[model samples]
Target chain A: MLDLFIDLSLFTMLVATGFAIVKMRRLFGVTMMTGVFSLLSAMLLVTLDAVDVAFTEAAVGAGISTVLMLSTLTLTSRIEKSPVHTPWIPLLVVAVTGAVIIYGTLDMPNFGDANAPAQVGVAAQYMERGPEDMDLPNTVTYILASYRGYDTMGETSVVFTAGVGVLMLISGLRRRRRRKPSRDEGEVS
Target chain B: MPEIEYILGHLNYWLFTVLMMTGLYIVVAKGNLIKKIVGLNLFQSAVFMFYISLGKITGGTAPIFPLDMRIDPATVYTNPLPHVLILTGIVVGIATTSLGLALIVRIREEYNTIEEDEILGIEKELVAQENRTLGDAMGGRA
Candidate 1:
């Protein structure tokens, strides 16, 4: 029953975001709504028993990504110039894809069913061995900080590189500032 | 009471979602930087809600020990995992916000306007002037 509610809420949030983006005039509002959609999706991930994924979704989706996108907005336009067009071809494709996904759901086990193939798979290994191998209490932490540490580390390095790039761009700006006073400062030497 | 528990359990999640989306919408669709930050906070707080919710158990007390007392084997224990996860997330969120604000301050200094359209227009004009100079320099090469 709770699963049903979670599914409904997720679908509603995502679909409403699509509609709101189409109807809204302000680009800022759309970005904010995208954050909302991401937050909702994170909640859905939690409900579906993917707590670690939920954490990443909540962090990357609503936190860092929103900030980065907003920063980009500072470099661009605020209001969308034109009303969104309803492109029939893309709409048709999305509709078909959505239909296929819904159809595929028919063959899947009931949400959280113990007998599901998904539950019977390598999940036990993740649960049982995760703590002993990684020396962490939480299986998700073991998975994130140890087993998938390389991937997360790569992502961290990407953020570090971006910070470096920003610093480089801004530092060159300081060089130009000092150069403007070169005639006065150079005379001192 | 069961129905009440059900309602309360999900109420936080519902409110979190609504507030988060409202903030995100403002950030994306609005012209103001401060408003965008406000939206960002909302989005982040919603995630915080998820973490808090995960730590809670029905009828369970806080995950604390009464060191002198004998432990009741039947007593339910609250989940501590989500709280720990959220603590790390909160630190990261604060860092991201500070970084974003710092970037905004720099942008304001350079562009003289926080409005997105105005900044873009100024940047485009600046680039266009440089392009014209380059075009003139290449005139001799052509």
Candidate 2:
């Protein structure tokens, strides 16, 4: 009973936060609300017994992303320009897509049903064999680091690529500034 | 009634749908580029919720084995695959966010505006100028 209450309350908060994110015009408010939204969803993940996901959500969703957005805001404008066009078309598109997704969900197994396909498939074998293979108490760590090591390596490379891309985009300003003096000397020559 | 039971039993999914649609609306309806990125983040996080909730078992605890590292055959463990998968997703989401913000920085530098409509207008103006110049070079109307 209490669990149900917690779920409903978190869901309510999540919906409220999402609406708030849409309505806010100040880009700063929207950014902060996005962080709050991540934190709220992290709480919901906790109730759904996804502590690891909750942790990652809180850290990445709320923590690093918020900081990055704030710094980005430093480079860009803090106030959003009010949209000139009517939003009805986007609203209609969203409504149609959402209705179709809900219709698809009608066939999904109930929340937390033990016999759900996702819980039974290769997941069953992972839980059964992970301990013996990796000897780790936390199955998530074992699966992420050992069983799916190659995938995690790929994810790391993606992070590296993104880092390099960011540097390529924004990190040239200081270097360019330093080279300006040399360019002036060449021009004078 | 079974209908009511069905709706109530899948409360998680209903809420997930609502959140997903809300995020989608923000992405589509909002004109500001940063706001669109925020919407994209919301959409991805909503998907993370859906997958994590699906992996949960009603009575199962977290997937950490007992301190002694002994496996009990009957002990129920919530699926950890989704959790592992979501970790990768969360990291990728950050990478995408940062890269997007960096690109937004470049967009602002070039266009001096972050509004999508305004950016489109600037690009259109540039294209028209290029077309006019090319027309003059081709002995057509300047």
TM-scores of the models, in the order given: 0.49, 0.94
Model 2: residues with Cα > 4 Å off, grouped in runs: A175-189
User: C-alpha displacement of B59 in model 2, angstroms?
Assistant: 1.0
Q: Model 2, A132-169: lDDT tens per residue? A: 78888998989999889999999999999999999999
lDDT by residue for model 1 (B1-142), tens: 7566555445545544554454455455555564466457555755575445544444454443344434465765444445445545654665566566557656765675666676778989998888888888989422
Alpha-carbon deviation at B4 in model 2, angstroms:
3.1
Give candidate 2's error at residue A177 in angstroms. Answer: 7.2
C-alpha lDDT of all candidate models, in order? 0.57, 0.91
Query: Candidate 2 - CAPRI tier?
Result: high
Best by lDDT: 2
> Candidate 1 chain B, which ten residues in sequence have the lowest lDDT sum?
B62-71
lDDT of 1: 0.57
